[model samples]
Target: MPVENSRIKGLYKQTVQERLKLVAKAAGLTDEHVQALSNHGELDDVAADRMIENVIGTMSLPVGVATNFVIDGKHYLVPFCLEESSVVAAASNMAKRCLGHGGFTTNNDEPVMIGQIQLLDVEDFEQATTNILQAKHELITFCNDVPSRMIALGGGCKDLEVRRLNTHMGSMLVVHLLVDCRDAMGANAVNTMAERVASRLEALTGG
Candidate 1:
């Protein structure tokens, strides 16, 4: 069921279960999605043990929904899980104010990010930087050497750079890998590429 209006008054007065049902109906969440949102959101003792290290337990937090959002002409009830109070109220209030102006819209931007490879104990920063620049094409190719859906979709290691950063420890050579991550957060892709190219970068710089 689609919601006719994003604005919903007195939502905070409802109980947690009541609010969950309301939001579930409004968003047309599947039964599985609704069940996942229940029981601390698929994050019980077993899940906690599998997810991270030294799992003691999972702490419960208040899950609040911020209503009155219309992005790209589609109504959405954004949910927030945090300890902070009044934040959800503030967001819902802001959405009501913007609802008169056709609500919020979206404009997609290229989601490119930079991943760094740190090289330490570089004796010749100038020479090392020069070597990296000369082999820029080769390094980029090496990063994208593995077959990937991201690379096939024209999003992968696209550019490279070498610079010197003076830290409290010493002046270290840093290699930046510019990657277009498409519609995803580039953490996994960027980090994997950086790790894959680390040995080569060290060899090139002799650091």
Candidate 2:
């Protein structure tokens, strides 16, 4: 069956159980989904511990909905789990006010990031900078050569940058690898590239 309408009248005025039943019926949710939603302690200590380093208990937050949001011409009831008061109310108010204009529109850009490699204790900063700049293509190729699913998906190292800095301890060189991460956050990929190119960078900088 197709969903004809999502605008439920006075859904916020209903009781918790009443609201759940209405939402479940409208969304064609199963009994298991409703049960899971109603249950409090869904995450046990073992699961929580595996998720994070601490072996302590889990914290709880109240879940509320901000209604009347129409993004890209589709209605959405956003769920927010927050401790601050009036946030849900404020969001709902703003969304309701904006409904007359066409709700919200969003644009996304291709994800790109820089991986920084810091080379300390450089004997000659000028020579080290020149050496790294001269080997820019090689360094960028080394980064792109790393085995990554992102590279296969049309994303990898784009360019290399060299910066020389003078500090209280000594002079150092910082190498930046510009990368296109595609859809991922790129932290792991960037860090891996930085670690793989560190020895070559050290040799170039004589640090």
Q: For each candidate, what TM-score against the reference?
A: 0.60, 0.66
Q: What is the per-residue lDDT of model 1 for residues 1-207, given as tens digits with 9 covering 90 to 100?
A: 246666767776665556667777777778876666665744564453333322222345445667888888988777666556567778888988999899998897678999999999989999999999999999999999987888889899999988899989989999999999987787999999999999988888899
> Candidate 2's error at 136, in angstroms?
3.6
lDDT of each residue in 10-129, candidate 2, tens digit only: 765665566667666766768886776555366553443334221112345445556677787777766665556667667877888898899889888768899998898888888998
Q: What is the lDDT of residue 149 in candidate 1?
A: 88
Clashing pairs in 2: none
Which clashing pairs does model 1 show? none
Candidate 1: list runs displaced more than 4 Å.
Answer: 1-67, 72-91, 100-102, 105-109
> Best candidate, TM-score-wise?
2
> How far is each candidate from the true structure, as Cα RMSD in Å?
8.4, 7.9
Q: What lDDT does model 2 reach?
A: 0.73
Prediction 1 TM-score vs. true? 0.60
Worst 10 residues of 1 by lDDT: 49-58
> How high is the lDDT of residue 181 in model 1?
94
